[model samples]
Target: MRTIAKLENVSKTYKLADDQQLEVLSQINLDVQEGEFIALLGQSGCGKSTILRIMSGLIKPTSGTAYQYDEKLQGINETISIVFQSFALYPWLTVYENVRIGLIKRQLSSSQEEQEITEAIRLIGLGGHENAYPKELSGGMRQRVGFARALVAKPEILAMDEPFSALDVLTAQNLRAEVIDLWKNKEGTFKSAFMVTHNISEAVSMASKIMILSSHPGRIVHVIENKMPYPRNEKSPAFLALVDEIHGLITTLNLPDTPKEHPISKAIFENAESKAFENIPYVQISRILGFLEVLKDDNGRTKIFELAAKMKEEFGSVISIAKAVEILNFIETPGQDVVLTELGRKFIEAESTNQKLIFRKQLVLMKLFRLIIDKLTTLKTLAEDDLKVEINNRFPYENADKMVDTIVDWGRYGEIFEFNADLKVFTQFEDSV
Candidate 1:
């Protein structure tokens, strides 16, 4: 099989203020073959999009190499085009114009350009909406425009960044079906496609191969091939087994900073003051509490999507909340079904005062939370700027901001510390209970 694109030991790092560095992509490698559709799967912030960007030549890797057609890819390779997750279409442009944008620089005549644009729109099922502007179109229609634009370029490869993530379920499904049909039929210049997504079922449904990535400083842990035939039965035993296999890969994936999982690392885990730079997630405590209550009432088990529907929340948002809750050990998930833990159930069943106690205990157990308490205890009080400076030494600037917020918000809930907003200082809370 001919290789269409390749990344050889690629790595990426972002330099933060004061000479600190945040490594996003490690010595990872990937390839897009002549006719294979690959799905790069991992948690958010795992550098999935960074890999896509490197393949598309939108950004250069800090080390190693990204190549297309055996040539080094520097900035914007001509053989690849991207379909963004946000449906990035120009508001000032009509459907015709939006689809026509990619083909504008081609050497084709005006008539040829118009013909190609019209046919591209028709192929993506956006026929007769040529004159419609993006603002006038539905979400599905807008994304069709995005697909149309990428197709009109007549590129050999399409790089999609969670293209269907922002759409409704039916719409995403419909669009995925349409694209698969095109790939199956060899309808366009699209010889291959690769995309980044967090959804396992979507990966199994779409790609011929799936690359699983490890968290924080992304590295490819395994590449599983989907050998099942196209139009494969999602309900088939084989398909279910594949899903379960990949799901296991994720659930048991080791986090880089989780030193407690190893015997020799026990010393590090015991020293609360040593782990001062725990990577804190951006989830709100309220969502964690809310999900716990819902799970408890629902017999402590429910499908992820079912929970989302019951709570009238978006699927992706609920997943983020679930991840946060999972990290704190309040929930255990065998697959997509989240089961509340014994602690989770206790939190829900306890009286108001007892609930506070439970919440506080859980917060203190968190490495990030405990770190903040440790700092405040030692310093008596520290201004937010000083705390942020302390954080900047460990994390990238943007992530440092989030870690700061997580400590402040969760710390306040635990009453582990008191914050004076005007002074921007955090002080230890008075003893109680």
Candidate 2:
């Protein structure tokens, strides 16, 4: 198979305020080849979408090269078309017009354009709704229009960035099946497909090759060649094994304090220390507590995937909650299983006051929170804006305001500090004062 799109030793970094750089992708290399469906899977904010953008030539890598058909790619790759997660439809345009936009750059005559558009609409099961506006369509139908628009151009590579994520589960399942059917049947329209998704099952079901990425300067850590036949049986042992394997890999990648035997924790912590401050996963306090409570109910041990299913939450969200609690030393992820620590059990079982004390002790142990508390200790009070500035100085890659809010939430919950929303200030908690 011919290599269609390739990123060779690619790295992407964004310059933030005060000359700080946030590296998103590090030394990444991948290829889109003919006769292959590729899936990029990772935690949220792991630069999966950025890889899609780079491959589509929507954005240039800060360093390294992106190649298309063995040539250095510049500007947009005419052979690639993308279906965005948000549907990205023009609300004012009818479905037909939206699909027509795909062929606008091509020098097709009016008749040719109409034929292609009509064929794409029909091919994507949007035949009767061509005249309807976006508002008239359901979430699944809107995504179908997105697919129609992407397919109308007859591009060689169809790139979808979480295209089905916004739809209901049933609708997403149906759409995924339809897309796979299209790939199998629609020969020569698109030679390859690349998708960025967080859904392990989705990737397992559809992708011929799955690349797993690590968070915080995302790197391709694992690539699985899925030999399972098309129309995969999710309930089958082979399929379940692949899912479990990927789950284990992703859980290890996301959780820093995995089993000591694993070398991943060393690299993860080194990366954290080099940055001076670890980027806290912006998870709510209640979610962290609730997650621990669930773990307690599970007799303090369960796989992360099982916990996610039990909580009826997405895997990424569950991972974030787990990371937050893990950072506080409330949980230890041994392989795929999250085992509650002694502190975690005690905190969950203790009265509210004891729980707060335990949480406070954990919060102060973290470098980021310790920095804030030390400043608050010396100053007794700090403005929210100043706190945000300090956080931004330490974590240039994060959203400063959002980080401040998370800090406030966690600190207030632990009784380590108090934020007066009305005054827009963070004051030392009364107990500490």
Q: Highest TM-score: give the candidate number.
A: 2
- Looking at model 2, the pairs that clash are none
- What would you estimate as the lDDT of candidate 1? 0.80
Q: Candidate 1 on 1-433: residue-level lDDT in tens?
A: 8888999999998876445577788888888988899999987878899999888888899999998878888677788889999999999999998888889657799899988998888899998899999999989999999999999999888888999988999999899989988888888679999989987888999999999987556889899989999887889999988987876666546322233332323444466464443556677778777888787878999877678668877554566677677766778766567888888888778887787777788778776567667777777887887777766644442356566777777777767888898887888889611
- Clash numbers, per candidate: 0, 0
Q: What is the Å distance of residue 78 in model 2 from its true position? A: 0.9
Model 2 TM-score is 0.89
The residue-by-residue lDDT of candidate 2 on 1-433, one tens digit each, is: 8999999999999876445567789899999998899999987889999999998889999999999989999899988999999999999999999999998788799999988988999888898998999999999999999999999888889999999889999999999999998898863288889999999999999999999998667899999999999899999999999999998888777774533222433544455553556678888899998899899999999989999999988798899899888888888887788999998999999999988888888888888888778888999888877767766555555666557778888898888888889999877887862
- Candidate 2 lDDT score at position 63: 96
Candidate 1 worst ten-residue window by lDDT: 255-264
In order of appearance, the predictions have TM-scores of: 0.86, 0.89
Q: For residue 93, what is the lDDT in candidate 1?
A: 91
The lDDT for every candidate, in the order shown, is 0.80, 0.87
